[model samples]
Target: MTTRARATVTVSWPEANTRRLARQHLAAPAPSASASASPAEAVGAMLGAHAQVLSAAELSVGLRGDGLTRTDVRAALWAEGTGESGRTTLVKTFGPRGTVHLLPVADLSLWTGALSAVPTGPNLFSKDARMTPDQVEAVVAAVGDALQGVELTVDELSDEVVARTGPWAGDLVMPAFQTMWPRWRQVLHLAGHRGALAYAPNRGRKATYTNPGCTPMPGPAALAALVERYLYAYGPATPAHFARWLAAPKRWAAEQFASSAASGAIEEVEFADEGSAWVVAGDTDFPDEPARGVRLLPYFDAFTIASHPRERLFPGTAYERALGGGQAGNYPVLLVDGTVAGVWHQRRSGRRIAVTVEPLKPLPAPRLRDLEEQVERVAAIMEGTAELTVGTVTVGPHA
Candidate 1:
C-alpha cells in the first residue's frame, strides 16, 4: 500500500489572526448592503451565539452584521421562535459547550446531530441523580411527544416527564444553586441535543421548554461534519484545543483527528512557532497580512471563547487581567490589532451608552480614535449614543 503526502502549509501566528478575523467578519467594516442579514443568518455562520446572557448574546450577533440592533436580535429570537415547529427562525437551546445558545432553525439538523454524539466525560451528578442511557432516551422521547404542540414551564415539563417515566426519574440527585435537581432534569441538554426539546420563552421569570421539531442526524458522519465546521471557523487548530472547546474527552478528540487524517478528511499545517494544526481538507488559503483593528467584544463572545492559541489571543498582561483562572469569557475585552489590549465596561442609560476602557498598555493616538469608532458602532447596535472614557473599569469578572 502506498501512503499519500498530506498537503501542508506554513502559517505564522500573525497570519492565523488575519484569516480568523476575516472568517468571523471582524477584520474590516461591516459591509453596507441593500438587504440586511437576519440574526439567524449571522449567527449560523459563527455556528451559534453564546446566549448565557441573552442581552450579551444579542449584542454579540448585533455587532457582526450590517446594521443589526438589539431589538432586531430579540425580535428574531422571542417574537416567533418557540419550541414548536414554525414558531421562529431561531431556537434557543443547549448548543456548543453544553451552554445556552441561539441556533438557526435551518441548521438544527446539523447542530442536534453533532451535539448528541459528543463524548460525555466525567459524570458530575451523584449516582442517584444520574439517568441510565435507556432512561434518558425514554425521557427524550416523552419530552418530544409532550412538547409537540404546546409549550410547558419547567415544573410542568418535569411533571410530564415524570408521569411518563414513573417515580425514579423524579428523584432529586444533582446539586445546583443550593438545591437538588431531579434526575430527569439533568438531561435537559441531552434532550436538546437529541432533537427532543429546546428552551421556550420564560413564563414570568420561570424558564420553559418546547419542541424544536428537529430530527437529529446522530452518527459518526454528523460528528465529522462538526469537526469540519470548527476548522472552517476556527481552524489551524489541534485536537486538544478542539476537545477543550467542545468539552469532549481528549483521547476521543485525538482519535477523530487521527482517523480524519488517515482518510484525508482533514489536512495538516505546520503552524509556525505553534507546532502542527489541522484545517478542513481543501481549506488552505491562509491570508498573509496580519489582522489589525479595534473592537469591543462583550462577555462570552464566541471569538474569545472558542478560538485557540489562547496565549496569542490573550497576550502579555491580558491572561492575568481578562481571564478567570485560564478560562475565557469572564471579562469583556478590548481588541486592538487582533490581540487583547485592555478591558472595558458599558453602561446603558436611556438613549445613551457609556463605555469605560482600561488599557493594559498604552494605546497609540490612532488606535484610540479607532477604539472611539468601535464605541460608536456599539452604541449604534444598542440604539443609543456612546460616550468613551479611558478610565478604570471598576467592576470585576462576570460583573
Candidate 2:
C-alpha cells in the first residue's frame, strides 16, 4: 500500500529557522540561518518560481491574503534579504491612482489584492454630509470636463471646479473632489494600464495631477487582468482586504474574486485561523518558513496585512500601539526571521537614522544580537554611513 510522506514538522528551533525553510522550499539562498550560500541564488529562486520580477503595485494586490498595506508588502520583501543593493523599497502607485507606495521589489507581487471604481453612490458620497452624491457627481463631471484636454494642480483644479460647478456650492466643492477625484484617477490609471490613456503630469509634488494621455478604455478585460495580477501576487486573502486596500466596495471586490475563481484562475487556502484565503497559484508561492533577514519594515508593510490572521504571525498583544489607525494606517516594523518582532521608528539626529525598536516582548539575547546585526546591515545599505543605537530609547509602558 502506498503511504504519504509526512511533511517535516519543526516544533522548535531558533525563530530564524524560517529563513532556512524559505531557502529550501522557495529556493532562496540558505543564509547564516543554515549553510552559507549566495544571496543571488535566493533572489533567482524566488523570481524563477514566480516567472517574473514583481513590482510593488503587483505584489500588494497579488498577495491579497489580508491586513496588508503598500508599505507592509514591501517590508516583507526586504525581510526576504534577496534584492539588489540599496533596493530597500520599490516606488509605485497605491489606491489613489498615483499615491506612491514604496514596496520591496523582490516580494512586490506578494500582496496583489483587487481594484475597482465605486460609483458616486450614497455609500461613498453620503447625503448626510453637506455634499450629496449628485453634487459630488456634478463636481466629478465638471472636473472631468475641465481637464478634458488639460492638466491642473490642486489649486488650479479647485479653481476649475469652482468655475464649472459655481462658488456657491461651498463644502460640496472641496469634499466632492476629495471623494471623487481619486475615483477619476483610478479610472484613468486603469485605462493607462490597458493602453487606453497615457498618464501625464497634472502638476508637481504639491501641484500634481493626471491628464488624459490615451484613448484606450480600461474595460473589463483590462481590469480583469489587473485584478488577476493582484490575486496572483497576494493571494489566499479576503474580499474585504482587497476592498480596503483598493478603496472599492466589498461587492466589487467579491465580483473580482468570483470572476477570477470562475475561470479556475484563483485558488483558495485555509489558514489555521483565518478560514479561507483566495490566491492565484500561477502567481503565488510561499516559503516553508519565513523570509530571512532582520528587516525594519516601514509603516504598514504588505507582509503585515496579507491576511486578517496576521495575529498568527505577530500577535496583537506583542505591541501596545496600532501604528495603522485607519484605512491608510501605517506602522513601521522590525522583521526578524520572517516574523514581526516589534515596531520601530527612526529619530533624526543631524544626518543619522537612529532607529529605536520596541519589541512586543523582551527580546532574547540571540534575537537581540540578530536585530543589531540586521540594523547595522541596513545602515550600511542606507545613507552609506550612519550610527545604529540599539535599545537606547524606550516608549510606552510594557504591559
Candidate 3:
C-alpha cells in the first residue's frame, strides 16, 4: 500500500497577515459586506467576541456587522423587543479562559461541552471547603435545577446551591476580581462550561444568571469540535496558542492537537517567523494581497487577541506601546495595514465622542483620512458625534 504525504505550504508573514485580515473581515472593501448582517453571524464569524468588558464586546460586534447599532447589540443580548423574534439570539456566558463572552445561543452546547471536557487542576480553596468530584457534580445539578426558567443573582443562586447541596458549598470564600466569592461559586464557572448556566439581563446594575437549555457533547467529541473551530478562525497556530487561548493546560492542548493530526482533522504547516503550526485540513487558500485601511479596534478585539506571532502583529515599539508587558485589553489598538500601529482612547462629552490616536510614528495623509473615516464609523455605531485628536502616545495605568 502507498501512503500519500501531505502537501506542505510555506506561508510568508505578510501573506499570513493578509489571510487573517480577510478571514477576520477587516480587509479593504471588507469581505461579503453581508457576512455580518446580524450579531449572531458576526459573533459566529470570529468564533466568539471577547466580552469581559461588555461595552467593548458590543463595539466588537457593531464594528463587524453592517448597520448594527449599540441598541441592536442590546436587543440581541437582552431579547428586548417582540416574541421569539424580539429576544436576542445570543447568550452571555463564561466561555474560553473562564472569561465572560457573548456566544451565539445555537453554539452554546459546543462551547460548553468542549470547555467542560478540560480538567482544570485542583480547587484553589481550603481543603475543608474544597468540593469532591461527586460534590461538584451535585452542585452543578443543583445549579441546573435552581435556575430552570428563572433568573437569580449570584448571591441568590449561592443560597439555593447551599440549600440543595449543603453547607460545604458555601463555607469557602475565594478571592476573585478584587472581591471574595464562595468557593462553590467555582462550580458556577464550570456550570457555564457545562451548558448549565448563562448570564441573564442584569437586574438594574446587578447581574443575574439563568439556565441555557443545551445538552453538551462528551469531552473528546467536544474538544474535537472546538479544535476544528479554532483552526478555522485562528489557525496556522500552535498547540501553545490554543492552550493559551482556551486557558487549558499545555499538555492537554498538545494532546488534542496530536489527536486531531492523527485523525487528519488538521494539518501541520510551516508559518513564517513562527515555524511549525497547524491549519485546518484543506484551509490553504490565501488572499491575493494584504488588506488595506486603518481600524480602531476596541479593547480585547478578537483579531488583537487571536492572532499569533506577537512580534509580527506588534512589531518593534508597537509591542510596548500597544501591548506593554505582554498584556492585552489594557487599551484599544490602532491597526494599520493589518498590524498594531498604535493605541487609542475615547472620551465622551454629552452626545460627542472624542477619539485620540497616539501613533507609534506619523501616519501619511491618506492613512489619516482613513483613520477619520474609522472614527466616523465608530461614532455612528455609538450613536454620537465624534471628533479625532492626535497626541503623543502614553500608556495608561490600565496599560
Top candidate when judged by lDDT against the true structure: 1
Q: Which TM-score value belongs to model 3? A: 0.93
lDDT of 1 by residue, 1-399 (tens): 987564458878888777887777777556456434578877876778999888788888887788888887877777643345444677899998889999888889998998898888777776656778899889889889889878899789889989998888788877889998788888888888888888877888988888977888866778888888888888888999889988888899999888888788899888866688898988888776777789899999888987878989999899999999999999989998889989999888899888999999888999888988899889988899999999889999877
Error of 3 at 46 (Å): 1.1
| lDDT string, candidate 2, 1-399, tens digits | 965333232222222234323432321221343443222222222221121123323322322222223233344334334355433333232322223443223333332222223322234434433454466456656655666666556556667667777654434322443463322332233332222222233244453444332232244554565555555434445777666655567897788777877777766665344455565645334444445545554443444444333454565653335343332124556666555667666654554757777676677787777777655544443432345555523543211
Deviation of model 2 at 54, angstroms? 21
RMSD of each: 2.5, 10.1, 2.3
- Which 10-residue window in model 3 sums to the lowest lDDT? 28-37
Give the runs in model 1 whose Cα sits over 4 Å from its true position: 1-7, 34-37, 79-87
Q: Determine the backbone clash count of candidate 2.
A: 56
Report model 2's TM-score to 2 decimal places: 0.59
Regions of model 3 farther than 4 Å from truth: 1-7, 30-35, 82-86, 126-129, 176-179, 393-399
TM-score of each: 0.93, 0.59, 0.93
